[model samples]
Target: MNSVVELRHLTKVYKSMIALNDVSLSIEQDSIYGLLGRNGAGKTTLMSILTAQNFATSGEVEVFGENPYENARVLKRMCFVRESQKYPEDSKAKHAFANARRFFPHWDQVFAEELIEEFRLPLNTTVKKLSRGQQSAIGVIIGLASRAEITFFDEPYLGFDAVARQTFYDRLIADYAEHPRTVVLSSHLIDEVADLIENVIVIDRGSIIIDDSAEEVRKRAVNIVGDADAIARLVAGREVIHRESLGRVASVTMLGRLSSVDHEYIADANLDLAPVSLQQLIVRTTQEGPVDPSAAATEVRSVQT
Candidate 1:
């Protein structure tokens, strides 16, 4: 498959704070890539650099096989829809669509109009006067209808309700099936988009920590559930990602794919194995260490002293 975007040793810094550190990644063409991580994990910075909205402090970035900075050819083919997108204070949904139509060569005015109605956005109302959900709807419409070859949605569904969010996902998948362009979606709502994404790229504290197919990542770990003692025994020597125990029942997740022999061993041990969800796996990998009880006690003692 062709690469739509490439980053080599990409680094971005702001004064004393490092936003991205030696990050290198290649986004495949015509795939829905999930750029996932916690807040302040360099996802937004990376997206901005890719779309030419922000400059990298060091290293290289290539979009459409060319540097995207000030390059109209590359800019015209990419759309970056972010929660912080700004419009004129007096602009309305119609006004935004008009601007998008002029910028994107493949803009579909008809589809944009349809989406405006579907999202129930008031055409005459000023964008700033609209509710947060309404404002998000406007962005979603443009991002989907623009039909840009590479589209980036940076938490674009912030104020939408569950039903509206579902509609956005359904429409995105349906349209992508027909159009087949590259999409990079950065969202904290990991479980919601798990099925839509074909690949996952996880960033942690300014570095790329996980990059693999959604399926492969899912298979990298397995969850076992059974009697507490048996489950503990099964995970005793493995790299445990997460563990939970309730009464006499326990569940444990560990890294590494299960081989045929391992599967047989599990069956012989009578422990039921289940596939781990993408959200669970991500949380395990990216979560900070458990709270320190001793530190909490020390703070309390200091207050008492």
Candidate 2:
């Protein structure tokens, strides 16, 4: 697939702190991508730079093969839905959708109206007076109805309840099926959006760590549960990101795929193997290391017995 956005050795620095460190990646056309990481991990900074909302301290950024800064041609095709969108003091939900229709060339008023009702958002109420979930619903409505070629949702469902959030996801997927576009979703709810995204990009400490298809990233790690000694021996020389033991039973999350022979070995050893979900793998991978070498190399906490 063709790339809709490209970055080469991108870096963003603010005074004494670095927000992005030599980041480089490509966003393919018509794909849903999860821009995931812990807070302060530069996910927002990267999206801000790509959309020309912020400047990169160094390196290059391209959206639709053109610089996004001050480039109306490139900017019009993109829509950025921020977590906390500011509005006019007395503006209502209707006013926001009206403005969105004016800005996004492909905005669908009918779809926007449908979303507004489905989310149960009040059009007459002032935006600021509306509940936080209501405010988030407005953003979700705009993001889905805009139909821009590229849409960036920066934690857009902050205050949505489970049912409301599910509505947003369902609407997004349904709309996207009919009108496929490049979508970069920056979210903390990894498992919630796991199946929605085709690709996953994980950033840690201002740098890109993992960028691959959801299927491939899922195979990056596995949980092996069995005898502590057998697991220690089986996973020896392998990178163990997390481990927990309860008496003699140990469960270790190890990186890398399991070979056919390894599966045989696992079965022979009476070990239970479980696939690590995307959320679990990422949590373990991005964890901060202990200061001591021994602690960092091997950490097996006994939760209970």
Candidate 3:
């Protein structure tokens, strides 16, 4: 896949504090990507720069093979739907949609109306009067309905309940499969959208820490539950992302996939292996601090062989 967005040594600074420091990465075209990191990890800053909503202090940024800053053609092809999205206090949902219809060349009124009904949104009500979830729904509706070539959703389900959030995920994938586009989603609810995104790019302390396929990333760690002594022996000198004990059964989440021989060792030692979710892996990875991208790749390969 070709890179629709590219950043080379991207850096963003404010006063003395650095929001993004020497960050560089590429977002593939027509692919769903998960842009994940802890709070204040510069996820928003990265997206804002990509969509031309903010300026970069240094380095280069390109979207759709062109600089996005003040480029009408590029900006119109991209839609940024974020939790902190703004609307006029007196404006109604339809007003926002009307503006969207005018701005997006491929806006689908039919699709937007269907989404409105599904989310039970009140069109006539003032955007400020609507519940937080309702306001979020409006953004979701526009994001999907616009069908722009590139879309960035920064925690789009901020005020959404469980069911409403699921609706967003379901609709996003359904629409994406039908109308393929480059979609970058930044969310703390990692596991929920784990299956939807094909690639995972994680930012830590304003740096690109991990960038790889979701499947490949998942295999980086494995959880083992059984005898603490047996677990201790297996994980000796290895990195343990997490660990807990319940009486005699000790659960340890260790970095690196269990090789076939390692799995056989665990079986013989009466240890049980549990599958680790993408969210758990990411959380552990972040907690572990500034993971070396090359080391992660090497570990993935070492365990697989």
Candidate 4:
């Protein structure tokens, strides 16, 4: 199927607060997707509903063209890895793997063993006694080894050091290359995984603010650096997301691609072009509004409007 997961008007309410407000979206097959948003933006709530870990107040949810709630067939094909994943006090890492092997038909024991060693996890240590990083490693190992068709990793890298995080990313890419599946990862480390995601889905205030290909998303904004006067002239009559200045030189990030006229303006004005960071774009768009940097020194000024 073209869409592996679909949600129609999904809504979840906890007393007075609306966790998910009539949200609707779809996930395509065999690609890595980044689910990004501020805390309480309904990101975790949305993924929880998709995995049947929680119930939606109102909506139609489908996985693999079938309702996933309580459906063993669909559940077995999916996996949800999160920092808060708990195991029994007496259970060890091996116990978790043993359970995963039984539940997931595609579970790969050899791969799991390899990951266990790579992450340097103690197989015999009780779950409760393991360090937070070690606990997170267990989740990572299970998620990767499960080999489920649709895996949701909801910030499973908590407590992971820089090296460990990079290892996870490297292994993830290599494994995905060999066995493609739909993977949706939610992380606050935007730029770190920016190169890994094919599609970006952003949620803000319980709603989807941006959903598009990564390439298209990055193209939404461009940075121009040169003399302050020339930069000002270049951005005239255009939407400016941010502007930073140092002495006479300035860097302005705006929300549009260059036109023939704009190109002429850049060349004639001796301006340099730089790529915009995907994280910065999302941060600007999701903020209450553009923030004008302080005039004390060189910084950014968001030209709203």
Off by over 4 Å in 4: 246-249, 288-305
User: Worst 10-residue stretch by lDDT in candidate 4?
Assistant: 290-299
Note each model's CA RMSD in angstroms. 8.5, 5.1, 2.3, 5.5
lDDT of 1 by residue, 177-250 (tens): 99899999999899999999999988888888788888777777778888887666665655676888899888
In model 4, the clashing pairs are none
| lDDT head-to-head 1 vs 4, winner | 4
* TM-score, predicted candidate 4 vs. hidden true structure: 0.90
Q: What overall lDDT goes with each candidate model? A: 0.85, 0.88, 0.89, 0.86
Output the worst ten-in-a-row residue range by lDDT, candidate 1.
296-305
Candidate 2's error at 83, in angstroms? 0.7
Worst 10 residues of 3 by lDDT: 296-305
Residue 76 lDDT in candidate 2: 88
Candidate 4 structure quality by residue, lDDT tens digits, 164-186: 99999999999999999999999
